[model samples]
Target: SQTIHQWPATLVQPVGSPLSLECTVEGTSNPNLYWYRQAAGRGLQLLFYSVGIGQISSEVPQNLSASRPQDRQFILSSKKLLLSDSGFYLCAWTAENYGYTFGSGTRLTVV
Candidate 1:
């Protein structure tokens, strides 16, 4: 019965702004948390992942960072966002054999 929660549903920001999105899980322990981005006319790409508390692995280095302050709490942050950051922000997690599930996602529009 694990579930993921993401906030704001949608956002609109200008170029060179700061961004922060939060995701949290319930009904699981030591889950693998991931942040992915899906751009228009492009496929999904893994940005960051956390295997446990305070253990995060970055798949790419850009204008983004991730953190896991608690077992089930994951946060995505950026110091100064770029126009390229405009895309769908999805939070996902996978179980041992249950596969991966994603959140509702935050549709970010940067102008």
Candidate 2:
């Protein structure tokens, strides 16, 4: 009964505005967590990942940062969002013998 919760489902923000997206997993422990961004019709780009609490790895350099303060909680944040930062954000988690399970995702639009 593992599940990932992500929000908000959609957002429209002005450029230079701060942003925060959160994801949390239930019924799992020490899962490999990830943040991915998918531009319109583009492939999924890995943003950040964590194998354990307080251990975050950035896959690409961008205005965004990620943190895993708890074993099942992951947060994505941006101090000032850029126009190019708009996209579909997904949070996913996987464990040994389990394929990745993604949350519903957040569609962001930077105006």
Candidate 3:
């Protein structure tokens, strides 16, 4: 019974404000974690991923960063957010046989 938890289902922030989003998994260990962003009607865009604790991979060049501080914990952070960064943020994870499970997602609006 593995589950992923993501916080702050919706957010509205001013331009250039700091951002922090967290995702954690239960009943799983060392799962591949990912951060994705989806625009209004566009497909999902991979932002970052982690294979293990302290190991992170960036899929695109942007103003965002991710870190895996624990085996089942992943965090996304930005020193300053941009208006272009506004979107639906999703946290997902997958194990050996289990398919990707995603969080409810956070809708971020930047003004």
In model 3, residue pairs whose N, Cα or C atoms come closer than 3 Å (at least 3 residues apart or on different chains), thus clashing, are: none
Poorest lDDT segment (10 consecutive residues) of candidate 2: 94-103
- Please give the lDDT score at residue 26 for candidate 1: 94
Tell me the lDDT of model 3 at 9: 95
Lowest lDDT block of 10, candidate 3:
95-104
My TM-score estimates for the predictions, one after another, are: 0.95, 0.97, 0.96
lDDT of 2 by residue, 1-111 (tens): 899999999999999999999999999899999999999999999999999999999998999999999999999999999999999999999956778999999999999
Leading candidate by lDDT:
2
Q: Give candidate 2's error at residue 9 in angstroms.
A: 0.4
Tens digit of lDDT per residue, candidate 3, span 1-111? 889999889999999999999999999888999999999999999999899999999999999999899999999999999999999999999866768899889899989
Cα displacement (Å) at residue 105, model 3 = 0.5
Better of 1 and 3 by TM-score: 3
Cα displacement (Å) at residue 8, model 3: 0.9
Error of 1 at 42 (Å): 2.0
TM-score of 2: 0.97
Which 10-residue window of candidate 1 scores lowest in summed lDDT? 94-103
**Clash number by candidate, in order:** 0, 0, 0
